[model samples]
Target chain A: MDIPTFDDVLAAQDRIGPHVHRTPVLTNGQLGDLAGASLFFKCENFQKVGAFKARGACNAVFSLTDEEAKRGVATHSSGNHGQAIAYAAGRRGIHSTIVMPKTAAKPKFDGVRGYGGEVVTCPPGTRSREEAVAAVLERTGANFIHPFDDAHVIAGQGTCGLELLQDAGHLDAIVAPVGGGGLISGTCLAASGFSPATKVYAAEPEQADDACRSKRAGHIVEDDAPQTIADGLKASLKPLTFHFVANHVSEVLTVSEKEIVDAMRLVWERMKIVIEPSSAVAVAAVLKNRELFAGQRVGIILTGGNVDLDRLPWAG
Target chain B: MDIPTFDDVLAAQDRIGPHVHRTPVLTNGQLGDLAGASLFFKCENFQKVGAFKARGACNAVFSLTDEEAKRGVATHSSGNHGQAIAYAAGRRGIHSTIVMPKTAAKPKFDGVRGYGGEVVTCPPGTRSREEAVAAVLERTGANFIHPFDDAHVIAGQGTCGLELLQDAGHLDAIVAPVGGGGLISGTCLAASGFSPATKVYAAEPEQADDACRSKRAGHIVEDDAPQTIADGLKASLKPLTFHFVANHVSEVLTVSEKEIVDAMRLVWERMKIVIEPSSAVAVAAVLKNRELFAGQRVGIILTGGNVDLDRLPWAG
Candidate 1:
């Protein structure tokens, strides 16, 4: 199916309202001065399971009928999406399994288990995990829940933009970090529906700016080895998500790794919020392309806050 | 001067509304599971100057007339309050002089300067910093802004509770870490005014539970040997604050150093907030006494987030 429409996102908001958090919107005056804009931070870092993934997870799980959910669910993600789907599935009292890279964060690995998902580890950077999850789903008759590519997931992710508009009201633009394009696709639908005057923009890490290049050239582009601190945005955009993003997102911007680190530090030091590098991508883009957002009220979605602090950039 | 009453706190809230943050509140189902209670965290860690100290600082600065502010504002603090008063005074175009212990965190020292304050460094002792500040105030005719002793400071501190109750609504109890008793005194007054059924409790480190002992004995007590991971709660309470706390607060609970560290880690890991040891005191209290708060809605004041990441427990 094509990407969910604005009507679909509104329906997703209704479907996911009971599951996800209505995370707070925050503003820091001192930080605002540095941005040279009135910035409202929609703190998805405080979202359930500590990222915007919960929106997609809830939409995917709830989209299933009781019989379909009873067949169980499964997914492959070493990060936020794994825990999100696990947490969402657990809430429905359904059996769920997550295929994760063996080298995933210990906290995240434990988080999925803590939320009652059966965890299966696979070799990192291999199709082994995906194949293993597909085998498990077939063997157990469990449904394979896509991390971001699924229509339900995009619709679910859109609920974040819906909530942002509900809380912060109108914004000149909404800037979101683009991964598989799930969040931005959802954000676009919501912004288009609620604040039709608002523009939707995507922030991609420079190392993983294939999505930006692809969007400009009107074709899919392979990742440039995908080496970025923003592990969440490393995924190649799916065709369905790319279609929505290409049609709806006003612009896609990129920022360097150094900018991501600096933005992460500023958020930790000034905003007192601990966000992962993936989350910092949005802030990095704002800072890198300051002219585009300066003097315009913008909503910057701080995506996640699950970074390992023991080796956080500021620690050294 | 006496400790400010609820009426006084409400007045201060009105006075300082323009200067201070009605700091956002947050919650997570994951973090609540650890404490075995639903929690509402008033994130004063996001307050101006990175702590609840901003409330009192703004109140103290604005309470002064034009002539009084022209003379300058002076205070002695380990860190947060000093930065707060500095920021507040700077907002009014007044000079600020902060006498801090030489051992205070480097970020805090930078914050004072960053906000345009003169720093007077003294040896690591309350006596040394107090003596240096007193001498400086006498010599320069700067107003001595007592960090948590003066009624205006306490009234200003109470504004945090005012903000908490506004959003957190009715709760079984509100928990805060007590040091000089300024934050707790204000919290108690606000709690009493907003929800008469709700109780106010103070969380203090067992190593420096002078406030707890004082509450039990109905008298102010100074600790000659104070030690705690929560450095912000190591000070002795003054007479005025002691009296208000004795009358308003329901109980003073103490937590072990290990619990403080564990709570700080839990907040950082689960709640996704960069809370300091001092702010962790209340979380420690809740986890330590789960039965008292379990199944009941509880509000916790996350007082600050200024700990050096380099010195984070996981790193060192």
Candidate 2:
């Protein structure tokens, strides 16, 4: 398998530049004081579809050949990625299908549909979702766009790190939440190519600590039915992402469920921005181990701001 | 009562330039579609102290003479204004006292105190709060910084409108929530001075529709104890603000409590920004009166993002 280089990321950036938002970098004096570090938050929460997934999905859909795009694009995600692909495909005037679990939240399905994507629901599980997607592919001949594992997706995600480095030059470290590791892997590639001295760290929820365990054990570690409030960070890293994580990532840190919620509330209160729990994991990691980031210029990737309004974690 | 001129606002902008954020103007395609207009949101929600109050507060604090600065400043507020004044005073290396009703939420008091302001709790009511503020002024020789209805404060609030017009030039109309009418009054002054043809509108909650009623009645109609979810917009218009509203404001629109909450949720879900109910009032007005603003370029001032997270209107 060929790894995506910095040049591929630049090409991906050009492809998605018109489609995706160059999301702003935000900072708060209160947040900085609390974390004991100068923090620059790459606010992908404000990105199209309210997540950084839009960048990768835009790159993937736009990268498709005219003949390939004519058939349409398909993905299985009850999350930001599903909405992102739908949005990207809709923007390009192409049909898109999203395969979601029947048990998934109504908003998730509605979000995809709102972006003009057709939704095909299956029973709740990886096997069921995959089978449903495959059936749809066979029936419609739509191209399958993997949520995180594709080279184009990683290259697109790398644009976020590139923007961060450009906006806040010479960061001491960069932190991002790790699920399937698409964002962090892309970040690592960007950092390696652009600013090799800047360290890249992956943050994970303790309940969904597959990435942390995989980094320690020197291999891909799968987590079956992992439970965490950070619904977006539940997936296990794939081989493509694991390869980059093993080769380039400086560390993988894990924080408790409570800490993630606390960090989410802190950001909302201090920065007055709506960040989802997955984004808070990166903040929680920094807050938990303050010494590592103390007195340094750190970049934090706020991955998304998609949340169930009726069911806020703080409400409990 | 002296009305602040556009030149005063320009000066205030310079005074507060180093202290406050020239908040970004944000636009959402989905929100625009919903409102049936091209909308430019002046995101004072991302401003210092999470509100546009910071602009006024900074101007007020920074405008004081050296002797006046040494004497300190005081205000009676249980919302964003208190925090803003405290934050501004702290930044100016001066003391601040915030008088609040004892019945106010603990978070409000904490917010004021967090900004290094002395919190003085009084019995719940206009009279009691005034007495408490007066007592503080007498005791400490502190200048009373009115939350609104002051030339300096209105000049500061006008900076928001100045920035909005500068960023999103030639708006057909600009809408802002009216409480004490500082923001709308300032906006009116700025609009009248810079773009005479641009109409200025005020949005108010039906529960706290003093500004709307006052505009129609041709006088200041005080709502002694208005109750609204838009806590930041409960205050009635004072004479200074009433002058601007009567002479410069084109219209005042009121929306139901449900509309305010719905608009808040719509912004959070679509724009993915944490805006307070007061800010949502302007969006609600645009959404409610779609025909009036349809196909027009509208600038909506998102006044603030200071809210008690645990007591969210949607959670109930």
Candidate 3:
């Protein structure tokens, strides 16, 4: 298994610069005052494919050989990563096949289709999705673009932190959502490489806090079946991701679903920016642990915004 | 009263450069396909007051004499301009007395108060709001800042256009929401000043299109008791605003409340940005007038995002 370094992320930035948006950094004076922290939100919700997943997806897709690219790419994702792979492949005029759980939101399925990718439905649960994706790989000989756990993917995702540091200049600490830990590992690598003075942290939802548990126990841990409004942050950490997170990250914070919802509402209401629960987890951590970050310039990565409008957590 | 021209708008860029955000020009392929035009949205929904009104209000507040600013500023508005004036004045440690219609959205009133502004609520009518504002002005000797029809306000509003043109370069036409013609007039002056070739237009809801009526009639026109989801655009044209509109604007287009709501929904659904109905009016115009703008870069100013979240049109 390969491990990505700062040089790989630097190369990925050059590769992906023309494709992705350098999303705006939005500041909220009210939220800053209330939380007792000066925050910088690298709004990856505005990134291509409406998430940070685009960075990983694009890197994996574009790194392939001409013959490999011709065969097409395959991935299994419940939501954001599926759409991301679809969007990245489509932009390069390459074919993409996504194996999605049937229980996934209709909007995610639509997003994959909108990006000109083929969708294969599987029954709900990890085993079924894995089986379906495996069957597709055997049948079509398509390259498996793992959502995380891949060195190329992590290096690709690292560009987001590279951008935050590039834009904000100096930061005391960095916080990001911990799903499968691709974003967090990438963030750790980027932060450690560029500025050793900055400490990296992971934010996770309590219901689906496998990453926090894994870090605390100093081993990979899986939830007893994941659950959270932050569907993008529901996945457990993998070996490579766990290695980076355990070594580089300083701490992990947990936020309740109510706190996540309140954070989402505040971003939508006060900042007029749309952010999903996964993104809100980072904000929730900032608001909840204000004492830890008071007067410090904290950089937060907004993970995604591919949410179902009708199923908004705050809505009745 | 002194009049503003393209020259004044150019100068406003130098004046308010440090104060306001040069908000991003946002576009997505999905949103572009729906409107049948190449749309570059100047996201003033991300502005200081959550709208372009912050530009004008800040300009007006800053233009006041030292003695006048010490006495504070007073205005009568039930929407974005009221909040803009309040927020802008608060930055300068200047007091603000905002007279708003009692029927205004609770969020708007709360926003004004949240900015350290004094709020005086009157009955839901022009006469009552005017009387209340006059009382405040007389009592405090505060500087009277008209929401529109003021040279400084219009010049401030023009700054939004200046930032747009700087980022987007040359554009075919610019469409902005019209509420007492403040943003539109400022946009017109800015557009003409920078690129004399770009046409400037105004968008309004059909129910309260006093500017559209005034454009055609060559005089100020009242709404005769207005009704529209675009609460920010309910104001009738004033003499100074009418004069600027008559001389500079290319045309005024009107859309139904349903169209405004539909456009607002698309922006939220596709762009993942929360925009108020007034901002949607400009988008609605581009969607309504596709033939004229197709294959051309149309600049649309998303004027505000101060909509009542509890009473969102989509929720209703």
Q: What are the per-model C-alpha RMSD values against the true structure?
A: 2.5, 1.3, 1.8
Candidate 2 per-residue lDDT, tens place, B115-173, comes to 89999999988889888888999999998899997999999999999999999978999
**lDDT (0-100) at residue A146 of candidate 1?**
88
**TM-score of structure candidate 1:** 0.93
Error of 1 at A237 (Å): 1.7
Encode model 1's per-residue lDDT on A1-316: one tens digit a residue.
Answer: 6667888888888888888888888877766788888888989888888899998998899889988999889999888898999989988989889998888878878899988999988887657876888788778999888888898899888988888887887799888999888999899889888899999989998889978988988987868558888988998888988887788899998999899999998888788888989888888788777788889888989888887767776555
Model 3, position A291: C-alpha lDDT score: 84
Best by TM-score: 2
> How much is A94 displaced in model 3, in angstroms?
2.6
How far off is residue A233 in model 1, in Å? Answer: 1.4
Winner by DockQ: 2
The weakest ten consecutive residues by lDDT in model 3 chain A span A307-316
lDDT of 3 by residue, B1-316 (tens): 6878877887777777777888989877777887677789999888887888888888888777787789999898877778888988898899999998888778878889988899999997767877888889889999988888899999999989888888887899999988788888888888888888999888999999889889899988888879888988887888888886787888889999899998998888778889989999999999999887888888999988876666678773
Better of 2 and 3 by DockQ: 2
* lDDT by residue for model 1 (B1-316), tens: 5657789888998999888778777876767887798899999888777899998989989999998988999998867888898899889999999998888778779889999999999998767877898889888899988888888998899888878888986788899999998899888888878787888999999999999889888888888768777888877999988986698888889999999998898888877888989999999999899888879889999999887766776567
TM-score of chain A of each: 0.97, 0.99, 0.98
Look at candidate 1 and tell me the lDDT of residue A304.
84
